[model samples]
Target: MKVYDDKHIKNVVFVGAHNSGKTTLAETMLFEAGLINRRGTVENKNTVSDHHEIEHERGTSVFATPLHTEWRNYKINIIDTPGLDDYVGEIISSIRVADTIAVVVNAQNGVEVGTEIIWNYIDTYHKPTLFVVNQIDHMNASWEDSIKSIKSLVGNNMVLVQYPLKIDGAQCIIDVLKMKCYKFGKDGGKPEKLEIPEDQKELADHLHNELVEKAAENDEELMELYFDKGTLNENEMRQGIRAGMLNHDLFPVFCVSALMDMGSGRLMGFIDNVAPAAADLRPEQTVEGDILVRESNAPTALFVFKTLYQPSLGQITFFKVKSGEVNLNDKLVNSRNGETEVLNQLFIMDGKKREPVSKLEVGDIGATLKLKHTETNDTLHEEGKKITIKPIKYPQSRTRKAVNAVNQKDEEKLNDALRKIHSQDPTVEMEFSNELKQLIIGCQGELHLATIDWTLKNIYGVEAEFKEPKIAYRETIQRSSTANYRHKKQSGGAGQFGEVHMKIEPWYEGIPEPEGFNIRGKEEVDLPWGGKLVFYNCIVGGVIDARYLPSIKKGILEVMEEGPLTGSYIRDVRVMVYDGKMHSVDSNDISFKIAGAHAFKEAFLNAKPKLLEPIEELTVKVPEEMVGNVMTDLQSRRSVIQGIDSEDHFQILRCSVPQAELAGYSTNLRSLTQGKGTFVSAFSSFQAVPRNVQETLVSSN
Candidate 1:
């Protein structure tokens, strides 16, 4: 194996919807590069990128797999990303480091909801993008229709760089710029170029003319030259097209059948000549404060994007050096913690394999093993360098499931393993309910949780049972009421006697804050740190001791942890210890604790208490034909339609729906749209459940 120099590097990410042939295309690229002796299939569990046991068994990618190849003096670092929405976090990590994103679209399926998702992220980041239409050999595949869908989903500026030459329905592409036609034989045999078919010259000419027009539009000089001469030379046209692609003025589309290993060689030319190199694309880095640092001379600064926990190999954190050079055993300080650690060794990763390198230059992506303080999203820089790099913002995980160790003995191991996993992947989070005695694991979706389960057993040597997570609900008061409780126990030499007279009312709405409350005429009730908590002294003639006031307020706070209606904690309620009696000798924290518990129950029951459930803002992307069905489904789930927008033959619907109503929403939406629609959800705010539904929740809890 040979390592290409830094100047020839090209970092590209392969992304798309599940079953869109991203992994297959990655395998094909590796095979064409001669890095692999045989092609691996997803169904037979022998793919190069999907090497993990879990991914192989499931026949899908769960993590981003990085591979390297030398094509035309270029070191192409290919990152194969999972196409499923459940592992979207993995895709995000891959895209963050990529200089260019290649969105793989299925020929038969055209544009899917997931494809639109990847497209939106790519556009948001303003990264240079390419559209690769894969599986063209599939029956009923239409290249023209697929290109039309791509243009509609993307923009009309998308140009076909390669033309598919169909021979007996086995699709093979012709490099339009090269002016050569090729055909594929049986069972992944080597491709052979043939003379251009007589009937296809006009069709090829049409695509070629369109591409040339786009190339001319990219350069004013070239456009004027074309106007004067009526044509552009081959070299001038290629230069124009490359410039247009780098500026994002045009997205060059390529057609290929990865299963047959066709059109990959021609695709390499586009990658080497047209794809932007890191140095070409990376903006100059500068200090935020007094000092300034350029990419050419700045001390080494690497941003860790992804981390993996291998039981046998410890922790491996992958990073991209934004500036300077990182050498072996170099000491770097973590900006977040200000702790220095030795770099040890830098390794350029290829799938699960690593090739150790002496040093990594600026704009190079590599990984280091067994770093103590470094984690994902952390920045490693020179010592005393108080600088921070921006982190890639990943979409928050919306789906959650409760898990427990299947074998009682593995409970502690499961907890420790999950924590390790979370440390490795920030996208996976865990929530524990002490009262409910359940460990809820939050992920991208159901498949994500399933993959975690499989990994836990296969890789971590721990087994767990997973169930749907229960909604985290809260109880709050609706009406106002007053109650009093007396605690008088005479069991020992010193007795306890205390009483609490307090009123409970619903907290003032419209953003719960300190200034939202005014104690009418009381001057001492204004506290800055206290939110929605008001203490009033309404005693007529010192019925309660002023010295014991703080104790009474503390007792009220302790009782607020639980409401009468449910075990969930109460929030935004103002409690006033207006008047209470306390025995100076016996009344202490313990006595007040008992009185507080009783008084809270009475007041809470008197005041009508209700349950509140968390609501989430949802954005569903679906084909235009399924908009009505999705809207109807949203309404059925008690969702409030905030707005809707149509773009590129798809409708994006935004709404706020209760989290409880969205537990199985992914599955339901798939069924509703027949696997053509999906959505991303975000936490909005906690809102009160309807009075009629509160009973059902409370009883279930």
Candidate 2:
């Protein structure tokens, strides 16, 4: 491997829906470029990208892999990404370091849910994008309908660059601009010029004309020449098309059978000629964050988009050098952690293999073996130089489950494994609640969490069990009440006497208020009950001692924690010690504590206690075909649909759904749409459960 300067490097990412041949296309590209002697098939579990044991067993990609190659004097750094929704975090992380994205779609399936998702990612980053209609050799493949679907789902800027040439009952492509047809399976299809097939000439001309028109539309002079003469020179069209693609005004779609190695070389050539480099695709910023530098003359700064945990190599950090140069043994500071580390070696990574490099210049993707403190989303830069590039935003987790070590002895081991995986992936969130006695793990979907569980057991040697997480429930009062309690205990040597009168009631849910009502349009009374406990000296005649007030409040909190009904934590209640009596000699803090505890418990029992359950503001994004089915399903869970909005080609349905009812919503949503529908839910607020539902829960308990 060789390090290319910013001007000669191209970082490309392969992205698309699940089972869209992204991994196969990447393997084909690597093989055709001679990076790999023999092409590997994913079905055989021999591919370079999906090398994890879990991935091989599941026959899907779980992480992103980097593969490097040289094409026409250009260094192409390719990132093969996972297509499943659960593994989309890998796709996003890969896109962060890419200058261009190749969205591969299955010809038979046309556009899918993942197609729209990856396209949105490309759009978000404003990167140059290309479309490859893969699996053309499969039966029921429709190139025409796929193009229309791409155009409709994406925009009209999707132009056909080359039309497939069906010659001698074999699948191949005709270079429309080159005016030559190439047939496959003959002499191994060395890309020799041949007469254009009669059946493809008409489609080729129409597609070529459309491509030329779109290219011309991007340039005034080209548009003038095209309108006057009905055609433009090859060079003129080339320049125009390049500009259109860079400006995101056009995305050229090409057909290919990646399994047969057809159109792979042509696709690489198109990328080399049309794809923009890092300096050209992304606006460079000065180390001072002043002027945007189009050329690479500034200080060194690289963004760490991903962190890979290799069993033998330890932690490998992957980053794209945005500006200047980074050399072996160079000391770089992590801007995020403010820790400095010396790079002992630099390598261009290919799956599990590494090609050592002397230095990685600007616009190149490189790796460093294990940094002290730097992790994903961290910036590595020269000391005293600050450069902050925007980090990619990942979608919120869609699935959550409680995890526990299969054996209590493996508890610490489970936590250790979780931390490592979480550090590598920003989308997987791991939390623990001492109250629930469960370790909560949230991820993109059920498959994602399951994959993590498998990895924890296999790679890290820790077995774990998973279950639906328990919602954090709380108890509060609904009405106001008052009670008085007196504690009198006499012994042979000493005596204890104390009395407390307090009121208990509901306050504003979020705001602290008085027991009965919150006074408005008036300044808050300087009552002693402001901070958790108030002792109103309405005892003007020295009824109770002001010295023992703190003890009473402390005792009140102790009783509040142990609610009378279900032993759940209580909130939104105010206690006021209006009046009390205490024996001067025996009424110490202990005596006051006992009196307060009994008084608060009496008042709470008299008040109307109710259970509060958490609700989430759920926004479901699904295709229009599943909207009705999803709506009806949500209704059964006691969800209230707030409204509906449009999200590009999908529907965004918003509703307030209870957390209890959404225990397995992720799995259910997938079943409803046959793995096409997905959603995100966030904590909205706590709402009281219906009486009937509460009765059922209470009885079951």
Candidate 3:
């Protein structure tokens, strides 16, 4: 392999919905570049991009695999990403470093819901992008519908570079930009370039003029040049298209049948000639508000975007050279922890294969093995430099399951495996809830969790099952009440006697002091579990010593930790120790604590108590036709619809629902909408449960 300069390197990522031929297209590109002798298919389970065993079992791409193709004078680095949104973590990490994105669409399905969902993320980054209408050779494929869908996605920015056509029972593509026709053979290898036929000349000419106008809209010089001459030359048009792509003002569409080896060569040629290079894209801003310029001699700075742990091998760390150049044995310090690491061996990754290289230039992506302390999203540079690249921000978990080890002896092992997995994929989070007494693992959805389960059984050799996680419910008083308790213990040495009288009431923000008592000392404590506890000391006559007040509050907290109605944490309650009796010799902290616990418990039962369950703010995006069915299912779960907004042909429905009612919401939503629905949810405020719901919960507790 040869080293390519910053201007000659292009980072293109393949992204789209499942079965859109993204993986196949990536395999085909590598073959066309002569990097591989033959192309592999997803059905054959030999595609370089989907080499993982888990992906083979699931029949889908689960990880973003990076490969390189040396085409002409350019080294095009392609990162093939999974089409399913379940592996969004992999997609996001790749997108953050990409200079251009290629969104593939299945011509049979047009633009799918999954495509629209992923496009939202791409649009936010504003990376130069193009659309690939693939599988056009299929008998059921519809180029017209695909064109309409592409136009809808980009609106007025859509520009047609090629359209699929069939001539004399063979496949052909009409290239409007060059006014040339490409005729493909039966085997679909290389195409024969010829002049446009007379019958289709009118349509070809019209689309060619449209392409020139759209390309010229981005650059003033191009616009002026186009007006001077009747049309722009080939090189001039390529320049304008590149300019339009960099500005995100135009998205060129291309057609290909990747499985048949048709049009992939042309696609690669266009990418080498027109796609934006890493240096041409905007410089990334560091965490310290510094810009990272792609200069080979500036400083040796590398950003670790991904980390993977292979059981057969050791840890593999993948990174992009942000600035400067790094050689085989250069020492770099991790900006996160100030630990020095030497690059022992560097290689440009092609799936699981590592091709060793002596040096990697700036703006180049490569991988290294066996770093001691470096992790994903960590910035490494020369010694004594403070530079950290902005880390990738992943979406919050959309599904949670209570995880348990099938073998009792493997409990600790399971915990360790989950933590390690979370390090590679940040979206997979793990937490131990003391209230629910269960270990919960959260991920993107059911399929995402399935991958985790597969990892545990195969890689870690631990058998684990996921169940529904229990909800963390809270208990609070609704009204004020007073109660008194006396703790008198006659043990040999001395008699312990302490009496406590306290008034308990619900606590709210900016709550006023009690009306009937004199407020002398007040301590407002904020509970760590999400509420407030206000303690009032109204001992006017000093009947109870001030020193024992802490013991009383501590006793109340013990009961608050496990609410009287349920084991859930108690919150937002005010307690007043107005008057009490104590013996000088017998009354101690223990005695007061006992009396305080008893009195608070009694007062809590006397007051009207209510149970509160967590509420989630959920946003479900689905087709408008299925809104009524989705709404009906939500109502059954006691969800309150906040609002509904429309986007294109989809509806965005926002609602608030109890966490207990959302045990299997992600799977249910997909089933209800025929796998065309997607949703994201976050923790909202805790609200009171209804009367019947509270009664059932209290009785069950």
Candidate 4:
């Protein structure tokens, strides 16, 4: 493998909805570049990009696969990303490292729900993009309708660079910019270039003029040149188009039938000659707020964008040379943790196969094996010169499930497998909820959790069961009350004698000291679990020794840890140990602890304890037609609608819903909207449960 300079490297990511032909397009491009002997279709489950076992079994991309093809003295690194929302982590990581995005649209469906979702990420990254209308040769393909939908769904900046033409029931592409016709044979390889047919010449000329104008508008000099000469040559047009794309002023559209390999070769040619290179992209800022330029002569720095576990090869770390060149045996320090790893071997990844390379240049993507501490989002730089790149921010998990190992002995294995999965895919989180006493796995959707389960059962040899996760509720006092308890027992040797009189009150911010009370010593401490605990020692004449106060507080904390109302943790409560009695020989730490715990529990019941349930802020996006039904369902779940915003054909509903009511909302929403709805939620605040619900919860407890 040969190393290419930054200027000759183009990092393009393929993004689209599921079954939109992104993987197929990538395979076709590789075949046209002579990198592959023949193109493999998704049906045969032999495509280079979707090479993962799970992907092959499901016939869909589950991971972001990196491959490269050489065209016109340029190396184009293609990052083929999954389209399902479940694997958005893969798409986001790919977009973070890509200079340009090629958003593939299905001709029959145009922009789909998945496409719209991915487009939001593309916009977030501010990546220059182009649209490819794929599968144009399908019997039910509608190029005109698809283009119209694209214009409406996307922006008006979309300009057609090529259009599909049919001659004798055979599909061909007419390149408007070059004013040439490419007619492919039945095999759809190595298209025959010829003059535009007489019938399509007029239409091609009009589109050619439109493309020229769109390109020229990006630069003053180009606009002047176009005005002076009434037209621009191919080279001049490409320069303008590249400038417009880099500035995000234009999104050129292309036509392709990836399944038939009809127009992919020309698309590859356009990318090689006109797409923006890594050097052309804006400089990235470092963690220290310094700009980092992409230059081979600069200090060596690499960003690990994705990590994967290969069955036989251990971990494969995918990274891009952000600055300078990295050669074999060069040791780099992980900027995140300061751990160093020597690059003994570097390889340019092509799907499952890797081609060994001695060096990787700046702006190039490659993978290294068995790095000690480097993981996704970590930066590798020169040991002495510490620098960190901005890490990619993934979306929070929207769905959760409680996972339990089938075999008690496999609990360790289950946790270890989950940790490994989280390391590779950070979007899937594993948390042990002390309040719920369940091991919960949170992910983007049902498919994501299902994949995790499958990986655990198949790869880790651990069978697990998944069910609705228990909600983490809280308990707190509603009013103030006082109680007295005495613990006295004579069991064989020394007797246990201790008495405690403590006042329990609900704690709040800006709470004043208790009125009509003589205060002695007050210490306020923040609980590790949340809320505050204010302990007051108002002992008169040392009725209880000062040393015993610590034991009393500890006992009170034990009761707080396991609330008297329910098993949930208590928060926002102040305990005042104003009066107590103790015997010198019998009132040990254990004795006072028991007395204090009993006293606090008695006062908690008298103070009107209440259950607090978690409330989450939900932002849901659904088709306009389904808004009424969705809102009704939310109302049934005890939700408070905040507001609604309309965009295109969709409505965005903002609501605050109780966490307990959202047990299986993901599955329900998908079913209600036929998988056209999506939502994201975050922790808002904890509110008291309703009276009826609280009664049921108390009874169940």
User: Per-residue CA lDDT of candidate 2, range 1-701, in tens?
Assistant: 56678878889999988998988888888888888998789989998777877788989888899888799999889999988878888999998788888899999988887887677778877777889999777788888788888988767888878767566676667777666787788423346568777877787788778878988998899999998999987788877877787787888888888888888888898888777777677465544566544345677888889998878878999988877788899888887678898899899988888888888888889899978898888778888877765676888888888988889999999998888898889899888875566789889887888789888978889889988887666677778778888899989767888898877656652655443432221122232312132333334356777777778877777776656666656666766677789887778888889898999888887787787788999999888888999999999999999999996657999999989999778889989987767787888887898988777766665
Query: On TM-score, who's better, 2 or 3?
Result: 3
- What are the per-residue Cα lDDT tens digits for candidate 1 across 428-514? 898787645689888876677777887798878897998887666766677878899999999888999888887766776463433
Clashes of each: 0, 2, 0, 0
lDDT of each: 0.78, 0.80, 0.91, 0.90
Ten contiguous residues with the weakest lDDT in model 2? 520-529
Q: Stretches of candidate 3 above 4 Å error?
A: 494-496, 518-520, 540-542
Rank by TM-score, highest first: 4, 3, 2, 1
Considering every candidate listed, which one attains the maximal TM-score?
4
| Residue-by-residue lDDT tens digits, candidate 4, 1-701 | 77799899999999999989999999999998899997898889988898888998888999999999999899999999999988999999999999999999999999887888898888888888999999898988999998997887667788999999888877889999899999888768778998999999889999999999998998899999999999999998999899889887789999998988888888988998898998899888999798897788889999999999876898899999998899999999999888889998899999999999999999999999999898899999987877899999999887888999999899999998988898899999898987678999889888888899889988889999999987778899899999999999999899999999989899999998887556788888898777788989877888889888888999988988888666888889888888888887888888898999999999999999999999999999999999999999999999999999998889999999999989889889988897789888988988999888989988998
Clashes of 1: 0
| Predicted candidate 3 versus true structure: per-residue lDDT over 1-701, tens digit per residue | 79988899999999999999999999999999998998888889999889999889888999899999999899999999998888999998888888899999999999987888788888888899999999999999999999999888889898999998899998999999878899999899899998888889999999999999988788899999999997898888898999999998899999999999899999998999988898888777889998987799888899998888899777899999999998999999999899999999999999999999999898899999999999888999988667888888888888899999999899999999998898889889999987789999999998899899999999999999889987899999899999999999998988888999999999999887789888889999999899999999988899999999999999999999998887789999999899999998999999999999999999998999889999999899999999999999999999999999998788999999999999888889988998778888888999999999999888898
**Alpha-carbon runs more than 4 Å astray in model 4:** 646-650, 673-676
Total clashes for model 3: 0
- Compute the lDDT for candidate 3: 0.91
Alpha carbon lDDT at 129, candidate 4: 93
Ten contiguous residues with the weakest lDDT in model 1: 521-530
